[model samples]
Target: MTQDPPRLSVTSQDVANHAGVSRSTVSSILNGKDARFPQETRDRVYAAATELGYRPSHAGRALAMGKSDIALLLMPNATFGPQLQEGIDSLAGVAATHGLTLMVRFADPDADETLRAILNLRPAVVVDLGVLDQAGRELVQAAGVRLVPQVINNESNEVDLLIGRMQVAEALSNGRRRLVYASLADWRLDPVGPIRLRGAEAEAASRGVDVTHIHVPLKAAGATEALAQVTAGSAERLAVCCYNDDVAIAILAAARQLRLAVPDEISVIGVDHTAIGQLVFPRLTSIAVDFAALMEALLRELDTNGYGPPARPDLRSSVRLVAGDTT
Candidate 1:
């Protein structure tokens, strides 16, 4: 297949010509620091830029700003849920406000090449999702790059603790006796999944609740048989604390196949208020994470924490129960 010719990138001069202004005027308005231009002129320049789909080159901006114009986000390869994607969107917005652009690169933290690339770029800020040790921290600080580690993963277990506490409390409040955790078996979600499982198990153990660990596959078919067996012939009211909304959806299908009434016979609570969860039959009740708040926390950590020490930023995502027909 013939590839399309590279679309000519619209430049600042092009925008200036379209807006009937000097290139320097376009540049000044784009900088947002110069207030010499009138508000109307600025608006006109912005409108022209939007119409042209003009984006400033990061290297150009970095040269002008005397620093990398990028907030580099690691672990771009991971499957980002809607909430994390929203958080990243908020991060990008914040970065843009600071005259920095957001860039994503796929490389595991353990790889030496990733560190080398990070040091080479020396981005304005590095928001990390994977492991970073003391050496990595020192390298980043030595290179004058600010690093924030493990924002989404509950390395400190605070967010997990809250999610676990909420799941246990909500199920117990509704008089659920047997609590089964839909533990994820995917290798992609290792530490986070285990951390969440621990949180739920800890809460259940404290309340004299028995939480059966069911290692469920990522797909819909992997869960049906296991769920059928678990909910087969138990006298107690069961509530399955799902790993996430996808697992919860699998449980829903499994419940349907087994001919069980939703909330009446078997209740289900999911984490992550995914879009599909809202539209499903007996709409999914989920512990919706506060992505906006988490984004704030990430920014705060970047500013305040800096790179003095290599530690997981102590952050917790605020959560709320979005009630639905499921539980």
Candidate 2:
């Protein structure tokens, strides 16, 4: 196959010659300010521009218009993860319909680097996933860009809340259910984890059942040791509520190693309702976290209300208990 040289850049002049009109008339017609031109003339200009593949230089347009009409979406950490990808998919779909372009970039929570990336963009709108630090926030504000944060839990109480409370409520509701909550130890300090633990504890106290929490350190090497500790802890009720599906699966794997049966010997539950959660044996029973709604609301906040409008959307998304074979 032969490569084609970029067609010599076609300009309004070429379009004018092809359409048999003055350059100013072509500009007026193309820019949609051609009220002075008759309908037939307008059509001719458009047809000629289309046939000649003439495109006006966007540099002039951008210079005349102060706003670039571009949005920068900032995400925390890696982009390849399933959860992040799902959010990107949802945002991209909505942005396309609105004639907006979404430029996604990973922003580190570090003080200096984070601020530089955000300030450089000067984006019209910024959607933050709580990945920015204090300095980054200041940079975003200084740029005159609106910031929209997605509050998934008690964590980073910066935006609207979407943490799953019903999951803890249900687990705590079962009077006979023995409750075991598991999560990474670092999460204990996170707004979402501790708040969720509180809900579980509150519900357990009301039911007159004791709740024991086991923390697994974030270090991968320590996971096995932590899992051993989790499974070894003696609980009468045997119902385990993990912080998320990742931890829940880890517990399940540990349980199998200990020769324990799921739901029969130990009932396991988790939050997030991720794809892997449903694929596991006994189909892990879990709380369906509404990530789609969370992302949608975050996007809407950036587009319409910006920051001061509202924390969450008027529409409410609920978390449901999926009674899988496990529990």
TM-score top scorer: 1
Among the numbered candidates, top lDDT falls to 1
Badly placed stretches (over 4 Å) of model 1 are 1-41, 44-57, 60-67, 133-135, 149-156, 302-317
Query: Which pairs of residues collide in candidate 2?
Result: 155-192, 178-237
- Model 2 global lDDT (CA atoms, 0 to 1): 0.63
lDDT of each: 0.73, 0.63
TM per candidate comes to: 0.74, 0.67
Candidate 1 lDDT over 185-250, as tens digits, reads 565535456667888888998888788889777665677788867876676678888888888888
Clash count, predicted structure 2:
2
Instruction: List model 2 lDDT by residue over 194-282, tens digit each.
Output: 55676677666766767778875534445556656655666544677777777777777767766677776677777777789899897
Model 2 lDDT at residue 89: 62
